[model samples]
Target: MILPYPFPLDIQSILNNKNIFRRPPTRFGKMHHTITHPFHTPDQLPMTNQRINHEPVFLLASAPWRESSLWVEVFSRRYGRVALLARSARKRQSELRGVLVPFVPVSASWYGSQELKTLHRAEWIGGWPQPQGRALFSGLYINELMLKLTTREDPIPELYDALEAVMRAVCGENSHTAALRRFEWTLLNRLGFAPDLFHDGNDEAIRAEETYWLTPENAVVPIEEAERFNPRNHGVAVGGNILIQLREGDFTHPESLGQSLKITRLLIDNLLPEGIKSRQVLQQLQQFSFGV
Candidate 1:
């Protein structure tokens, strides 16, 4: 079957479904088509006046706004990813200033009807420890990935849980690489574009002794078949055993973590837009320090 260019990956649709055991759907044998911008709730309510009820949320990202108000983006357990205007948060005297930092859990309340919601109250959860150095950067990378991949007001409770787990791992001083790999694998699977690591395009199960190549549109295949259908330059070659382990999310296996790092990098690079600064910074850091 001929594959379409610029695949949707149908991340949202997949996550919304309660059933995760079924084979996720695939798009193929079609002409190329461009996807339009997803429908956003810009017109649903004026961000400046609507009121959002208070609830516990994970602070994903925050930036300064005006003189005192800070523009914050949070992944709320109840409201999903949202934009909030935290009044006077940038002020040195504001209690909310330090409480809303990224990776911190906060109980936030807001009200607004405009495109930008206004923050009414924020209280820190206070128990979780701060992430340091590389873990901090890794947390930012996770936030960036969510911002780029998720839609506002769209809830992925499972993804939220995974994010919290990653934060916990980071806070407890676990290997950031393992944390990232697991979280990323879950994120991709949570979104519909999860790779079919255990099977070929023709529905045959892969053997552990074989070598394989993966393509964004075609899933996985034997290296020989991939070279015949598409040039070797177009795909990333990986070991079959790694593919099987990834299929099972066996991140504890030494090979799984290593392969996860490699495969996730390729997937993110292929999925994201060009000139993403985070990716550039990550590449430079890798060159200077090899592995994280």
Candidate 2:
């Protein structure tokens, strides 16, 4: 993935910098325990004129803002994507330093009426072990998607759940291509950009025996109709069976997996005009690393 604009902060550099975060504790520590909070729908969260405390969050991206402060982006279950200013976070003993790492679930508190809020507190919650090696890049790729595709303050709880599920799956032993595909599909569906795999442009129910083209405009059309409309850019030719499999979230077949990947890539590229940087890094690693 190639982003239109370079990220202000380099994730690789941050990961390499040993002084950025403190070492993890051996067992349950003051800041490493689970947070208990009353369950509420995202809409129930205070939108204005109040401070939100200990909201469940997953750090998406961060960058240095001003002297001793960090600009943080997080995906909150209650508030969606939020921008925060962590003051004095660069200080060696600042509480926010260790708590702000990516991929871990954290309970964060912030106060402000403006677009960017002020971080008051952050606490790490237990989660699956951090993704390593290729899984790490894949996790970063997922973060880039969240950062690019989601709008700040627009809450989508389902997407948040999907993120956690995909991250856990990606960190496991096997390559999680199916998990990634499912996540991409879920994200697009939540954002209302998912193509109707079960129906064609005319809204007719797709037949399992028919072949169709997934058009650039995100419509499914019968191969014959697509050829008549425009043969040059009728989209990628996919089998009806594969489309059905994708619609049902079943990627058991290699053909379905391949077609799903193509379709998801097209949809994500359509949304992210600048492309994704982490994806480019992943491709590079795969190309150079022997049997990565």
Top lDDT model: 2
Off by over 4 Å in 2: 1-47, 229-234, 290-292
Candidate 1 wrongly placed segments (more than 4 Å): 1-51, 282-292
Give per-candidate clash totals.
Answer: 19, 3
Candidate 1, 72-98: lDDT as tens digits:
667887677787778777666877766
Q: Give lDDT per model, in order.
A: 0.66, 0.72
TM-score of candidate 1 relative to the true fold: 0.76
- Tell me the lDDT of model 2 at 71: 71
Model 2 lDDT per residue over 179-207, tens place:
99989988777766667776787889988
Worst window of 10 by summed lDDT in candidate 1: 1-10
